[model samples]
Target: MGSSLFSIGLTGLNAAQAGLVTTSHNISNAGTAGYSRQSTVQSTNPGLFTGAGFFGEGTKVDTIKRAYNGFLTNQVLSAETKLNEYDTYSTEISQIDNMLADPAVGLTPAVASFFEGVQEVAANPSSVPARQSMISTAQSLVARFQNLSQRLNDVRAGVESQIKDTVTSIGTYAKEIAELNHKIAVAQQAGSAQPANDLLDTRDQLIKELNQLTRVSTTTATDGSMSVFIGTGQPLVVGTNATTLAAQSSRSDPSRNDVNIITQSGAAITIPENLLGGGKLGGLLAMRSSSLDTAQNQLGLIAVGMSTTFNAQHLLGQDLNGNPGTNFFTPPTVGVQRFSDASTASPQVDFADVSKLSGDDYKLTFTNTTGGYSLTRISDGASVTAANIGLSITPAATSTVGDSFMILPTRNAAANIGVSISDTRMVAAAAPIASAATSGNLGTASISAPVVSSTTDLASFGTAAAPLKLTYSSGNISGFPATLPVTYTPLSGSPITLAAPVASVPYSSGMSIAVGGVSFTLSGAMQDQDSFTLGPNAGGVSDSRNAVQLGNLQTTKTLLSANGSPSATFQSVYSQTVSAVGNKAREVKVNRDAQESLVNQATQAQQSVAGVNLDEEAANLIRYQQAYQAAGKVMNIASKLFDQVLALGQ
Candidate 1:
């Protein structure tokens, strides 16, 4: 009886000691991150059975249990990853938002100022200072575009760097988690299938950290090791082995960085970027794809549109040097990124029509014979055949199926754009042709200045020495070249085309006439035998008609629209870019806030289940202390009883 009492008291003492040690451990590690509250699990030893009845033996500690609920933990992790994603996106896109939307630094004011200078030149075509100022403003505008493009390029480089850094961090965490998995597995296996509570907590913490960089999922094996996966179940860690994630140059565009995983056999597998979602890496990619790339393309589109339209008009005008104006701004070239090395050189991409340039990159894949190549609009995933996208894509000769290319029509236009001419005299401010009535006219009729829509026809019509003389006879204007086409539009009626330039049967006051490409307005009545002359505006120093036309281009809808029209202007496209970035920034900020709240709530929920509470641990400390003392007292009593039994034997 004494021996049994001593054994029971000793077991009670041992159980109480375990309880104290576990409670103390919880208190000590309360501030440690990822620590789950642990407690000793107690079980009474199987009751000793006798013929009469069963007798109670002693209590034993089953296992040290970690207070963790996988469901709640997973919920926290999910919310945390989403919150990180939004936070990263919000941070990254705000740079573009502030850069494009700010009134002082934005492209809108620069464009307005450039057109304002053009208006000054139009207002005084002969003013050297006005022309100089226009040139200066043009330079400033080009500088502004280049500056903005540089900023965007810098941001892109930073994003790529950050992606690499994030990948490296993820790889490091993967390796650490793999090591922890091995450690925990070995510990548990060596300990009667019991969990290594502290090691498990450490591993879980590593997973939580890894999730911040990229989303992750995990599974536990029967050997107590966790298998971690990311991006549609791509294994990051499996038992003692870890897969390393790396960032590499994109196959289609080398300037772009894409994420991939390195396998055990040293082969790299590129992860489809769309499937990799929910973390810092995902946010960076999302920002680039959704906003950054669009902003740069839009800016470059405006640059190309402005330069192309302005240059075309400038070419049509006569400069002060009596020469047809050259390009005011250099024409922009298209950018191409090839996928393979077997290229017969990427096809030169030029703008066939500036109005049809959509600012979206086109993918040209060589299927070898679907008319040599297929063009796809990257922005919308719509197939645009090479014939209709307003791009002159000359197919490559030795292009194999392994070769593909990305045609970025406007992506780098702004950076490469420049003012082509430096001399202010090169500014085209005069009309190419002039029209006037003969001095001997006897009628109150006057002819408007001739607009030479086609310089070729203007060159063919006449020279300033001998103009095309039109005589008003009865009701017809004659002396036009018979080979050229002539059309007349009455003020209140539709245009009527004469069957042949020689057969002008009718004429009226307030009528518009087009002879070949030259057009003029005839207002008021012309008496019999009154005459007008159309010829080149040679030495017309004050001719500002073309300058006026150039000024009018400021408000022209020259930028491309989705419906295949020049529907957007330079200022409006920049405004659209600003507005898009602003709206997206606001959206990301809102999502970041909402997701952050969710993260907090989820963390609190999970913490409530597994978090160590100091006050509760304090209560346990005293409770276990008392139980230890009571157990000691029982053991001391049993010892005394045993001593008395031993004395009796003595």
Candidate 2:
């Protein structure tokens, strides 16, 4: 009986020692990151069988179980990922908001200044100082465009660098997680009843870190290994193997970087930008492809619209030298067209009408062999019929079916926009042609200002066939040679006449007429022998009619067919872009705040389950120490009883 008591006492002592050690360990590592509180699991040893029921033996330690909840861990990871996503998105969009809305340095002031200068030139058409000021303002406007475009490109470059760094970090995390998976599986298999709790905690911590960079979904296998996936179930880690991710330049746009997974055999699988959502990397990718890209393109659209419309109208007027005005601002080009297939004939694309531009990239594909083509606007995935928009795509006669071309209309327009003419004298401020009656005319007949109805008329003015004479007759105007086929519209007849007889129109007071593509009004009573001369304006330095029209372009609906709207002005489009970015930034900030709150709640819940508590551990330490002392006392009593029995025998 004494021997059995001693044995039970020793067993109790061993179990109590283990409990004390575990409690002390918990107290020591309470502040350690990723450390789960451990407790000693005790089980009573099988009681010895006796005729009078079973006699109790002693307690034995079963295992040390870690405090953990898988569900709560997953919740923490999800919340962390969402918070990172919105935080990153908000940070990126704020840069653009500040750029576009800035008072002193933004495009708004430059636009207003440029138009104000144009108005000044209209107020003083013959003043060289006013024209010079107009030129200076135009140059300043171009500089603003170039500076803003470069800043946006810089932002893009920064995003690319961040993406590359993020990809590297993700790859490192994946490889490390895979290595931990191997270690964990081996340890769990070797120690079957007791899992490798500390290793599991380390692995979970690494997954949380990875979630901060990009969203990841995890699955535990039966063998105690984890599999991680990202971006639409692309495997990042599977058991002991991990796939690496690389940041590569995009195929279509070399300036942009795209993410691709590198397989074990060194094969790359490109991940679409849209599929990547939730976390820092997701935010950066979304900003680059959607918000940032849209902002830059919209700015380019404003530049293209203003430059093209102003230049076209400027060309319609006469300059100080009595010559037609040249292009005032450099026109934006349809950036390097990329073709999907080889074709002998390439299509030429130009902005035929600024009012019809939608500021979207396009894809042109030949549908059939008979010169039929289909154009698709990439922004909203809207199909653009040839007749609907002003983009002119002239395909080569040899262009066959299956030929495809990518057209980026406004992507790089702002960067390429510049001042085409440096001389202020080239600024058109006068009408190309001036109408007048001869000084020796016999009648009170007078002519209105000549309007060049078409580019054909402007080019033909002052030519060998121009400066034609018109002699009034009894009932009709004569002097137009009958041999030459002429287009004449009577006062009350059809609006258009193709090659009609010159004398077919009946003369009337206040009659409108068009000859050789020029339109003018011949009003007042005319004598039978009255004559008028139609010629180009040789000196128009004092004229400001064209300058007035140029100034009017500021409020004109130049950017057209945007979002199904018939037209939009330069300021309206830019304002819309600014509003969009501001709204997105605010939205992201609110979402980030909400997500952070959720993360905090999840962390607290997780901590309650697995975190160490000093007060609880201290109590456990005291209890285990007392139990150990009592077990030792029991052993001492057993020893005393054994000594008395031996003395009795002696």
Candidate 3:
């Protein structure tokens, strides 16, 4: 009976000693990250039974268990991922917002100054200094556009670099996690009664760190190995194997960097950028695809609209040298990128109508050999035929079905915009034709300013078929020539002679006449022998009509949407772009803050469940020490009984 008591007491002592060691370990590692509080489980040993009654045995230590909640850990990881996503997005987009809103460094001041210079030129026509100032302002405006484009390109480059770094880091984490998974599976499968708590903690810590770089979903197997997936179930790690990620150029747009996973067989699988949600990498991809791309395209739209409209109107007037106006600003060209696998020839793309441009990219997919192609606007996913948007696609005879092309109307416009006319004297500011009454006119007949109503009129203005003369006789004009036939039609009556020269034609007040593609209106009573001259303006140094028209383009509704419903002026579009970026930045910042709070709450909850408490560990230490001393007292009592029995035998 004493020996059995001694054995039971030894069991109690061992159990108490184990409890003390576990409590000490928990107290020591309380501050360690990812460490879960561990405790030794105890169970009653098998009882010793006798005829009278069953005897109680000491307690036995079972296995140590870690205090971990999978659900809470997952919640914390999810919140952290979302917070990181918005944080990165906010940081990147704020750069663009600041650049666009800057007073001195922004495009607003440059646009205002350029138009102000145009106004000065209009006020002082033929002033060399004023024209030079206009040219200088135009050059400055062009430089501003180029600088902004370069900055945006730099941002793109930086995003690409970040993506590469992120991919490398993801690969590193995947490799490490895979290795840890193998180690854990081996340790867990060793059939040991002890749980590998430290290994599990280290693995969880790595997964949490990986989640911040990019969103990842983890699944644990029965063997204690975990698999990590990203971007809608694309495996990053499985068991002891990890798939590598590479930052490569996009298949459609070489300028863009995209993420792809390299398979074991060396096949690359592209992950759609939008599928990657929540993390720094996802945020960067979103900024590049949506925010930055839209801003740059809108800026390019403004540049194209201003340059094209201004140049078109400028060409309608004559310059200081009595020559027709040339282009005032350089026109931007359309961008076309053909797929590498496409067999069709690249189509010719141009801004057929500046007022119809939508500042969006289009995908042209040829469906059949019948010269049929479907056009899809990338921004809105609206579908139309190529001819619907004024795009002329000339497919090759060898073109096959499924051939694709990407057309960018305004993506590169701002960067490539330039000043076409360097010489200020070439700035057209005068009407092509001048209208006046002859010096010998005997009536109150007068002519308004001559307007070259068509390109045909402007082309024939100074040619041999021009300089038309008209003579009035008995309320009739008879000086019309055969080469330049005149169409005389009354304001409220039918035309008299629209063919060759007429011997006699009835003339009335407010009569309209068109000759050689030029139209003019004459008013008031005309006497016999009254005459008028319609010729090109020889010296139009004071003409500011075209300059005024050029300035008017600043407020003209020249930009149109793909469907031609929404339209805006140059300044209006720019203002909208600025407002959009600012609003997006504010929204992302708010979301980031909210998500950060959620992460903190989740983390606290997780810590509360699994965190070590020093006070509790200290109490456990005292309890286990008392238990060990009591078990020792029982053994001492047994020893005293044995000594008394032996002394009695002596």
Candidate 4:
């Protein structure tokens, strides 16, 4: 009986000691991150069989378990990932918002300055100083474009570098997590399937860290292992194996980086960027596509529109040196990239009509269709009509099915724009053609100055030797180009075509007529015979007709037709870009703030279940200490009884 009492006392003592040890451990690690509160599970030892039925023998520890709630923990993780995504996106796009909206570095001020210079020249076309000032302003505009382009290029470089670094970090986390899985499984198997609480906490912490870089999904196996997946269910880790994430150059454009995953069999598969969402990586890519690319492309759009239209009008004008103007700015080239496995059917861009150009990237996919290729605008995922883009595509015989090409029309136009003419004498300020009624005319009929528009389909206009002549007789105009047709636009009607050999036409008081490319207006009464002469503007130094046309381009709606309007001017396009980025930045920031609040709520809930509490641990410590002392006292009493029994035996 004494031996039984002593054994029970010792068992109680051991159980109490265990409880004390656990409580002390909890208190020590109270401030540790990710430390869960642990508790000792006790059960009565198997009672000894006796005549008094089964009597309670002692207590024994069953297991050491942690206080945890998986549901709350996962909620925290989900909220954390979304918050990080919005935060990263907001931070990145705000830079663009600030730069684009700022007047100091923005295109608005530079554009205004440039057109103002043009107006000054129009006010004084014969002044070389004014023309030189226009050139200076143009160079300033070019420098601004280059500066903006370089800044965007720098941002792109930073994004790529961040992607690569993030991939490396994710790779490291995945590898370490896989190793931990092996360790955990081994420990669980060796320890009789008991829970490894500390290891589990460490693993969860690692996952939280990984989520900061990229979002991930997880599943636990029965063998205490886990599987991690990302980007449309692509497995990143299974059991003890970790897949490798590689940051490689894109096949379509070697200058750009793309993410790929090396599988278990070592086959690499490129993960679509859109599929990798809800993390820092996703935020960087979103900023690149939505804000950075659009701003740069829009800037280039303004560059292309201004350069092409201005050059066209300048070429139709006569300079101070009595020479036709050359290009005011260098022509912008369309950017294209071919896929690696695509056929060698190189696509070419024909800029026959600059008005139809857009600030969107296009993808050309060749198939077995009648035209053998389809064009899609990448921005809105819409098919681009030939008339809408105003570009003709002719497929080569060598073109094969599945051939793909990326066309970037205005991607680099800003960077490529430069002044083509350096001499101020190259400024075309006079109209190329001049019109006057013959001196022999007797009627009150007079001709307006020719407004030469197009240079195509027309030969050299009137010169000193042979002036193109027109006659007004019987209220009908005659003497148009004999071999060419004419286009006439009535004052209240659309333009109509007249067949070649246009002998005569009954004229109205205010009639517009086009012979070849030159258009002129005829108004006033005509006599029996009145003749008009059309000739080149020779030595007209004070003519500012072309300068006025150039200045007028500032407000002309020639670009950004795709941005919710039929046409938009340069300043409007830039302003729209700024507004879009600013709006997006504000939106993302709001979402981030909301998500952060949700994260805080979820974290607090998770901590309530798993986090160690010093106050509770202290109470447990005292309770177990008292139990330990009482157990020792019981053992002491049992020792005295056992000693008395021994004495009786002696």
Candidate 5:
């Protein structure tokens, strides 16, 4: 009986102490991250064995368990990760939207202003001031284009930098996780449950962060280690070791803006992980590649289109003050020659100095019955044959500047025979001056600025404003001496001729001017064959006068304009930007609201399951106290029994 009573007292004492410790532990870790309250589970000790069977004696601690649900924890983690990604994406989109849509610096207003300037020039074509305004406006417009392009480029560059940073971060996380795997595995092997719970918490936190940088998948090994992998089973971590990730420049051109990820083993991994819907890096990359690049390319295309098309029109039209010259605009070309003569074993055409010439300036003329020739320019380094030109030419020993090759009437006139300047950077050949300059040549000129409010001027210039006039010189030049090298100097308004054996020569309009075997017709007045138009085509690199091509802006796309201007070619780009912003804004608002509701619900559920009840704790304290007192009484009774036995033995 004494033994039974003593065991019961010991059991009670142990139970009370365990309960108190559990309560204290819970209270101590109440604010700890990811900590769950622990409960002391009590169970009756194995019953004392009697003659036939065992009977329950007293209570003892069964197990201490944390109050937590894995499913709920996982739900919270997943939702939080998605919420973080969306928040980052929305924020970045908003910044980009502000950049594109800010009215003070937007492309639309600049485009509108440019077209308006063009209209102003058209209203008063002869006005010097109007023309100057057109030039100024064009300069401003090009400046804006450059500015927009540079800004987009900056954004792209920033994204590239961020990608590098993310790669480094990914590497760091991978290494840390692998190290933790080593530690955890070592602890597990030591025959203890091992403080693995803390390790798991840390690993989970790292995994969440990793998911934000890129897509990742994880697998558990039998040895309590984790293996993390990326796209296509590219292992990031295996057991205690991790592979490193690096950013490398593009293979095709290192200088260009591109990057790729290489594994520790030097294998390039195709990681569009940056495009996955997980992290800030992915969103930033998408923003740069999908939208920013497209916008820039669109702008470049616009510039190219304008340069090519406008030059074509300007080439065909005769400029005022009629100067016989090559077309003002020259587009880029592959320097290749077309052999017009099919029958002739050898036919030669030469333009050693094609610096001042363009393919558009060339015109074919047939003089002999043996005509049928093709002209083709080589592309890249490809050879061109007479067949390629789609026309054949008869034998001729030598081709001169004036000689021409006739196109077969049956052949398609459009087939490659006349490819308009596909590239805007082509250089053209320069022609010789016509009227020689000598002493006593008449050439004084003055240009008047357009009057702003003269009815007569307005009527003349098509603008409700005063008209302006630019003067030119036209007269006989025979009185002056000739055959001497004469330098031509351009005056403020026009070029003055000096030395001249004034050759009075009148030919039908549209007579082709052949320079270095390339021919173009002159539709305006000229002092013999020497007059040339001041065109958009600038001199080539070798020539000092190669100003036009070098001075103009080079672009590949158009910009959207405000006010619905016809010249606004990139309206779609702006429209898409606006749409993206609106969509992101809507999505953010909706998601944020939804998240708030989810948080509230989660909080309520957690409170129900894990919230501490002070009253319950107080009741537990009283119950433990009573149990302790009862155990004390049992001890006291045992002591009394022991004392009585001792007295009897004595």
Candidate 6:
């Protein structure tokens, strides 16, 4: 009986010791990375002989197993991937916005300066210094355009480089995943309780990283190996082999390189999974074409419009020494057509000087909805019609070679007709040449002398009939009727004589005219409409003249109409640019919010199944302790029984 009692007590002591050891093991690995707490499952051993009725042997440990949920672990990895991708894309777009919107460091100031110079020249038409200043400002504008374009190109290059790095990282992670798959499969086959759990953790981590680079989905095979595929169901990994990713320039444009992932055996695969909901690389690609390229092209288009329009006008008008044709701005090439280039050329058309030639000498050619124009010039009481501008290149004997001339093309509101007149020079009357008319001239010449009579001549220098009548059909001058003639005229209004000669100089370079019943201001301020408008009494008038005058050369906003109403040509481009910017910003905000919500849901799901629980571990510890105690009780009972038998023998 003492032996039996001692055996029972020893069983308790052994059981207590085993239970303590199990608890310690669990505690030790609690802080270990990727270590799942282990549990000892106990079961009773079978009885040796049970023919009649026999009690079972003490409990034994069935297996030490890890507690894990595959679905929960996968959910965590997937969430992490999406979070990284969204975060990456958001950061890239913010950078793009910063680059574009930067004020002092960007193109805005340069554009402003160019227009300001134009305004200054317009306000001071006769100032040579002002004209020169305008030219310098124009050059600066072109330089800024080139600089901005280069910076954008650099951003594109950086994105390509980043894509290459990302692809390399994807390949590295892919290889690691393949290796871990092999390890896990091997562990399963070997019947190990761990089942390469740590390897699996590492694989999960790698896959999360891969997802951030691009979108991916996975399938578990029967053998426990994983098949990874990106968007469009292209396999990235199958069994032990991993597909590699590469970068190559686009087929049509070698300057742009795109990422491609394929199998080790060279099967093409659809990569750039992140592009659909891509990360940083994807964001850049999206913006590269949409915002960056489009904006640059739009800016170029603006420059093209300005240069082409100005050059067309410059080509038609005679330069200050009456040179028939000199290009105002050099014909533009594919891209470089800045207005500043037009402002700084030699013998440049002075936007400020409206006094150089006859009052009616200025001719503006307008290609309206109608095809042809018959225009008139109002200068020195002399009127030249569409039929008179093509007179002989040289003036008659009564006319000097260096006489100033005027060609006026007016669009009459009442007549609904266009008339252009070119007439030879007469000395300015009392008022300024721009506002002077027939009453201002002191000469004997009259308006009808050049166009109606062939015998009239400028007897003295200021004589009115000495000037020739030039006429143009449409915008083109067809002929000049040389009815009046005069030798060189002087300050005394005396014609050149064999005894007393006179000095004559070429006509001034700049002139202005009133079209459509309103005078269009040509001040430097007229170049840019950033802070100006042509509304009724706002800047000038409610007519089409003010609209065209206030029209922005740099911006695509139709300030005026060709037929004198509101213009639609310029407003369209402006509206389109504004819409594009707003849309991109909205898209970024929406995607960012959606991604955050998805991450939250995924995180909660992962936590529900995979998260650690201290209370559950405690419960498991107690259960394992009781089983160990039962096992020890049987062993102790056997030992005491043997001891008692030996005592009996003694």
- The lDDT of model 1 is 0.87
The order by descending lDDT is: 1, 4, 3, 2, 5, 6
Best by lDDT: 1
- Cα miss at 63, model 4 (Å)? 1.5
lDDT of 5 by residue, 1-650 (tens): 77777778888888887887777766665565555556777888778798888866988786666555556654554455455555555665565567667887766676567556545545544444544554565556556656766676666677678767877898899999999999889876784553455466568668767866765667888888989875445678899988877766643223223334565577774454433444555555555544554444444434333434334333322223332123332242222222233233333333222211111212243234454333433112233444322223344643443344322221111111122322222222111111112233233211111111111111222211221111123432121113322223222223233333433222333332222112233333334313222112122222211122212222212233233322233345445645665666567657756865775676456645555556666677777788778888887897788788789977
Which candidate model has the greater TM-score, 4 or 5?
A: 4
Candidate 6 Cα outliers beyond 4 Å, as residue runs: 1-54, 57-74, 192-194, 262-281, 287-291, 299-590, 614-634, 645-650
lDDT, candidate 2, at 94: 88
Backbone atom clashes (below 3 Å) for every candidate: 0, 0, 0, 0, 36, 47
Q: List the residue pairs that clash in candidate 1.
A: none
TM-score, per-candidate, Cα-based = 0.97, 0.88, 0.89, 0.94, 0.57, 0.58
**Clashing pairs for predicted structure model 3, backbone only:** none
Q: Scored by Cα lDDT, where does model 5 land?
A: 0.48
What is candidate 6's local distance difference test score? Answer: 0.45
Q: lDDT, candidate 4, residue 152?
A: 83
**What tens digits encode model 4's per-residue C-alpha lDDT throughout 327-398?**
999987778889888766677775656667767888888876443788898877898765578466666656
Highest TM-score against the true fold, candidate: 1
Q: Better model by TM-score, 4 or 6?
A: 4
Runs in model 3 deviating more than 4 A are 369-372, 387-390, 438-446, 450-453, 459-466, 469-533, 561-566, 645-648
Candidate 6 or 4, higher lDDT: 4
User: Each candidate: what lDDT?
Assistant: 0.87, 0.83, 0.83, 0.85, 0.48, 0.45
Error of 6 at 241 (Å): 0.6
Better of 1 and 3 by lDDT: 1
Cα error of candidate 4 at position 39, Å: 1.9
TM-score for model 4?
A: 0.94
